[model samples]
Target: MKLDLTDRQNQVLQCVIDAKQQKKRPYTKGVVSRMQEKGFQITERQCAYDLSVLARTKGTGIIGMRWGGGRTLWIYDEGCIQEGAA
Candidate 1:
């Protein structure tokens, strides 16, 4: 499904996907902090909201907090189209 997100939302989701692909846990707060460090200017609450949308939105196939020892992390499901997929 197409996610009707703003450009900044897309960027944050892309970052989460990249981090997961690299075998790093994409925790909401951590990702937000990293993005801010890189000058993205996103807040933790915003990240949480986006992540919740990803998890709850149908056809997005974005998984949340799976098997990470209780840490709030997220990853896109394998069948979901990635941010940059053709």
Candidate 2:
């Protein structure tokens, strides 16, 4: 299904993308926090929701967190990219 993201959601997604690409690392709480400091204003809950949307509709790989852990991480599935590019 096609996901119709709001401008804010797009901004959040771009933030995630930039963070991942810039450091060649997964999405983390620190990354999100830095993005928030840069003016994203998103909460951890919102980030989780956005991640869910990306996983379900956009097919971006899920940002995983260890069970009962503090850090968060993402894996960008190449399939998601190819699908989006198609």
Candidate 3:
């Protein structure tokens, strides 16, 4: 399904993308910290909120934390999925 992301959600998504690019890692905890380091005035909860949205919406190219169970869990970027699909 197509999904429209808010500005904040997009920012959060971009942050995750950049972080992954630099660290070669994708995960929730790092995303939360990265958001803060980048001066995004949001809490981990808020980050998780956007993540949940990205995860649920098919084709968004993001995979959010499912079950809220692991710090090692990550946000995935699917090169195969384009913005048009999202």
Q: Check candidate 3 and list the clashing pairs.
A: 27-74
- The RMSD of every model to the true structure, in order and in angstroms, is 4.4, 3.8, 3.4
Top lDDT hit: 1
Which stretches of candidate 2 lie above 4 Å from their native place? Answer: 1-3, 59-71, 77-79, 84-86
Clashes of each: 0, 0, 1
Task: Give the alpha-carbon lDDT of every model.
Answer: 0.73, 0.61, 0.70
Ranking by lDDT: 1, 3, 2
Residue-by-residue lDDT tens digits, candidate 3, 1-86: 44588988888778767866776566666777877787878877887788878767677677654455656455557662665443
Residue-level lDDT for 63 in candidate 1? 74
TM-scores for all predictions: 0.71, 0.63, 0.71
Candidate 3, lDDT over the whole model: 0.70
Worst 10 residues of 2 by lDDT: 58-67
TM-score of 1: 0.71
Query: Can you write out model 2's per-residue Cα lDDT over 1-86, one digit (the tens) per residue?
Result: 55578776666666667766676555556546766777877777777777656656544443444446555565555566656631
